[model samples]
Target: MDYIIDVKELRKEFTSHSSRSGLKGAFRDLFTRNYTIKTAVDDISLQIKKGEMVGYIGENGAGKSTTIKMLTGILTPTSGHVRVNGMNPHKDREQFVRSIGVVFGQRSQLWWDIAVQESFRLLKKVYNVPDEFYNTHMADVIETLAIEPLLDKPVRKLSLGQRMRCELAAALIHNPPLLFLDEPTIGLDVLVKLKIREFLKEINAKYGTTILLTTHDLSDIEALCERVIMLDEGKIIYDGALRQLRENWGEGKQIQFSFAEEATHAELQSLTHDHLVVWDQGSNASNWTASVENNEDIISAVIGQVVGAKKIADLKIVEITTEEIIRNIYEEGAVRNG
Candidate 1:
């Protein structure tokens, strides 16, 4: 019944000014201002329970960053209400911030000229972390993230991967229960990305740390989050389990079959529904491939038809990937908008 984050009718608006072009128009516009009101977040309401790992995702200009800024107290909402740990984040910034940690992948909180360890010490003083708590947390973080080797190196000299590890440690030094990760694995190689994902999983499992992750990487969402909230043009279009999202919007599973003898296109067409079969071609005289929808009944029917007519050599079914599902959703949105 307890929620770490609660938002109701949350909205953020900004006024942008436009200037006239050309010398004469610019001179005339100097005495006048043209301002337009843009809404960055539009009446969104969501609740995140304790220990929940939620993915906040959207395309560019979808207002993902705006929502996170409001939740973290960096920007105040223009209207509506937001509560983190039962306190208004913007109104009670000091006390509220202690309960949450934020990491901006494109930015650094550590001093550029200082060693990673020195930054941790400075954060200790700033957050007033107890010596025992700091030591215990740091030990766990260092081991989990493998940042021991990079401790003595200046933050500016560390590689992107190493610096990201240090950034995660700096955020966790206070042992905050909630974490907001904005593109935590951006620009990292595959190996480094896997390590970061593993580290996040470990922390969530060990500490039950609630995390709200925003990223362009669908892989991160698939690996780390059970539930997802998708945004489009400052509005939420989907909010539910990852599996459910796929079921609702995903292209069905792809079924591939190889036959003992080559089946002509007309012969294959006679076996299954025309729309259900996607690819119908043979690599050689005895090899052929075909695709079908994911429905069990459909698959069964297609298999029955094909097996009844010819000898089957091989069969494989490929499930729709998370990335493919998301792309479908985006394309659907674009079509609808257009």
Candidate 2:
């Protein structure tokens, strides 16, 4: 099988010069430089096949950006090998970039002073896109992202949400096979986020585009990616199905119950000391909650008993979120070292 991305024992390090803040230290530093070496990516190996939407997640300084930079041909690896589209990103940069599209949430790829449509036209020429394909692809993205109205507006004049929509369109102008997204929805409103998410799904389904998404927002990961690769301290700590990660790392789950209005306080008072506890809301004794330890039959048993005791209005079993699970792993040093 031909993989879109293949990395083996990849490592990157940076050396910085430092000195003590004093007249004598400054004089000593000038003659003999003191250098500190820090590793950004350390001995990692991974592969991404075509048409896979994988989530690459981690806290700040976890080397997520560094790895992406190396993959995009923006930075060279210090050691090991990286093959993106069957070529070395650094050695074959110009050719490598044509096979991939990258969107940095904090940065703009478009000419800031230029109209959105003008920027798109320039990109078409830069990528040497055929006029037929450009017209067809541009229409698809514009309709999906709803950015045709903003097409005449300069990039500097668009709002954050509108600009993000345009940014995505810009990246997809050439319809590259592999796309890399870094915090694609960092600070967008809910409606804008939904639009972007749906648009990505359509792109992947329509063209089989492989996506590697990096974001601080777990919702994006939960919504788009099936497989997740988590990094910490420059090393991969977890990489597998998102569902499996939740099952293994999640602390627990909560089962919330809502009773009928007619249920008296005395009728539900026993539940507080029993398996479930009452969350006193105003004068109503309706809302109740229970904590189920991990995945077990105890949840079923709890529900059975609750059903027998009261007129159930609503019942919801809430699983622990991905963010909470990740936090617990980091706090407890439960790194997978994948």
Candidate 3:
């Protein structure tokens, strides 16, 4: 299994000038200025095998964009190395450019004044794609993405969903083996987001294109990516299977129950072991939630011990979501180096 993307000890920093305050401070700036160095991306390393769709997630200012920029050859790393498809992206600019595609949802790659088809045509020329291959691939993309009706419409006239589909088509027209998607579904409705997810999954399955995605929408991560790498404060805090991350960060189980009659808080608290009652529905309704340790194994036993079939009306138990798990990891305690 060959790795298409390899990164090692990548680091990036930015120096921002301090703003002058008041007249004295402004005049003092003429003589000297102060600057603060912000570590945007600390030393980080990872390898992505070919045909792998990875979800790269992190909080704001967590260096997600900085890492993307380095991987896409948009910015040179202050330190360390990055190799995509056996080429140094920054050094072999032409070769790298031809072998990859990028789409930033906040920005448009299509010409605003031209019809979607025309922009794709221009891309065909730019990538120097053969006419036969271009036609075949374009037809397939249009059909798969369901952009046939919007192809002839100018980009500016298309709805956000329509434009996103076109944008995806444009990025792949050249048939780059690797795709870098930055928030491809940002600000879209639920239906649109689902549509985009389906399209991306289809392309990856059909073409085996290696995809590196950076997104805030955890649903996108859950829906598309098999592996996830989490970053915080410019460092790789968690990296591995999404399941493992959830197992470690998430409490074992969330147990909820509704009784036919009100139950005392003391009785509920007494049933818990290491777990704590993070939320309670109150005695009036006989509903409550408790964070139980060894949740999976102990929950039922505790329920039996505590409730004792006290005419419970409803009961629900399930594993926590990715969002809740990640939140727990971040909020658990002091940040540790990884």
Candidate 4:
């Protein structure tokens, strides 16, 4: 496989100091300094092939942003190395940046007060994009991302979802081969979220753009990335196929069913393990839900005990979600132990 991103032993750290607010404390802190070495990124390595969409996930201070900054040449690593497109990003920033695009969801790359199209025009001049290439690329992106209606609107006047579409289009104006998305779908409705996911998939399939996405939304990881890299306390805890992560650390598989009439909690308890997990009583209390670990030894037995042809109105098996997987990893420390 041709690797687009090759990182080895990458580490980053920052010096945190106690800053005093008042004059006395400020003077005291200035003379008697107190600081601590905070490791924002630990010794971590990863290889991503061209066209691969990988999820980089962690808690707020877990070094996700630190890794991104290093990759994008915004911050220098304390140690280790990173090569994007076989070139040192920090050393060859100008050339490397031309081949990659980054979208920081919290910050707008587009000018705030200007029209969206004006911002794109400015970026074209900054990136030195040729007239033919710029026009063609922008046209394609506008059509694909459905940003035509947003072109004339000032960025400040657009809704979050609309602005995000414009942001994506702006990132692709240069037609970079690599894209870095940081919480691109943080605040959006279900329909808009689905549209963004579909658009990303289209881009990956059509252009083979390698994407590294950092997001709190687990569904983004689930829908887009086949491989997920999980970070905890600046160290990579899990790096593998999403399916493998689910099978290994996911709590269990859920089996939901609806019945003809209300079923007693006691009767439901009789159907599963001694420690049963079920959430049934809604407006329609007749429906029952239960989940159990999907293991070879008891899967069939569990299914048989839970489902009967007529008793169950509907039955389906759902693998544990990425959200649940991460939740379990944090709360129980199961994945870390393994």
Best by TM-score: 3
Q: List ranges where model 3 is wrong by over 4 Å.
A: 257-275, 280-288, 294-297, 301-314, 333-338
Model 4 residue runs over 4 Å out of place are 19-27, 255-290, 295-317, 336-338
What's the TM-score of each model vs. the native?
A: 0.84, 0.84, 0.87, 0.83
Model 4 TM-score on a 0 to 1 scale? 0.83
Q: After superposition, how far is residue 259 of candidate 3 from its true place, in Å?
A: 8.1
Alpha-carbon shift of residue 6 in model 1 (angstroms)? 0.3
List, residue by residue over 1-338, the lDDT tens digit for candidate 3. 57899999999999999969999999999899999999899999999998899999888889999898888888899999899999998999888999998989888999999898899989999999999999898898889888898988999999998898888899999888899999999988998888888888888899899999999999999999988988999999877888766666665676788888887676666655445445466456588765566554577676675666467888887676788778777787434332
Cα lDDT for residue 161, model 3?
85
User: Model 4 misses residue 127 by how many Å?
Assistant: 1.1
Model 4 Cα shift for residue 23 (angstroms): 10
Query: What lDDT tens digits, residue by residue, belong to model 1 across residues 1-338?
Result: 79999999999999998887899878978898788899989999999998999999999999999999999999999999899978998999999888888999999999999899999999999899999999988998999899999999999999999999899999999888899999999999999899999988888998999999999999999999999998898988888899888777655776667787777777878778645675546567555555567678887787788888889888877786788677768877842210
Model 1: how far residue 123 lies from native, Å: 0.3
| Highest lDDT against the true fold, candidate | 2
lDDT agreement of model 3 with the native: 0.84
Preferred candidate (TM-score higher): 1 or 4: 1
**Residue 163 local lDDT, model 4:** 92
- After superposition on all CA atoms, what RMSD does each candidate show versus the true structure? 5.0, 5.3, 3.4, 4.2
Q: Per-residue error at 162 for model 4, in Å? A: 0.7
Candidate 2 per-residue C-alpha lDDT over 1-338 given as tens digits, one digit per residue, 9 for 90 to 100:
78899999999999999886799999898899889999999999999999999999989999999999999999999999899989999999889888999999999999999899999999999999999999998998999899989999999999999999999999998899999999999999999999999999999999999999999999999999999999999999998999889878675777777877555555555643454433334335677656566546766766777688778899888876788788878888797643
